[model samples]
Target: AQSVTQPDIHITVSEGASLELRCNYSYGATPYLFWYVQSPGQGLQLLLKYFSGDTLVQGIKGFEAEFKRSQSSFNLRKPSVHWSDAAEYFCAVKLVRGSTLGRLYFGRGTQLTVWP
Candidate 1:
């Protein structure tokens, strides 16, 4: 069984400041990892994913993440934050094996608040 955990239930950052959201996962083997953001009354949009290769992966909206196997973590980072970036962020994981969409799981949810 694969699972994802996001420690922070909410985070507040000033506009134009750096931000980082923590994420951890539990899986038997290398799993597909993702960071998604959802605005109020909107759908989740893929921020990034780790399938293979380089640990560092770039995502939309100037976001990026690093896959740390030892720590079982894939944390999201953005050097500068914006008012528009304030939203809910979710960490999700799925088996690298194909046809396992049913195994995908998401975190409780992390609300990001940005102050101007």
Candidate 2:
């Protein structure tokens, strides 16, 4: 069985502080991993993805993540936090969908709070 877990339910950081959101997954083998962000009223937006090749993948909005196969973890990070960055972040895994677009299995999500 493949599952995603975001241990931290909520995290608060200063406007210019560094931020790190933890994510862990349980899968039989190396799986497709992703990180998504959801604002108050907006739909989920892809922050980054790790399909193959480089383990350290760059994403939009000055965000980045590293996929560690040994520990089955894909954690998200940002050098500095911003007031507008406050949102609910989710870690998800893509599952094969048999000839169709793969389905996404998301974690409970970690809510980010940035204080100015």
> CA lDDT of 59 in candidate 1?
96
Residue 11 Cα positional deviation in candidate 2, in Å, after optimal superposition:
0.3
- Steric clash count of candidate 1: 0
lDDT of 1 at 2: 59
- Go through the candidates in order and give the clash count of each: 0, 0
Q: Estimate TM-scores for all models.
A: 0.93, 0.94
Clashing pairs in 1: none
lDDT of each: 0.92, 0.92
- After TM-score superposition, what is the CA distance of residue 30 in candidate 2 from its true location, in Å? 1.1
| Model 2 TM-score, all chains together | 0.94
Candidate 1: residue 87 lDDT (0-100): 97
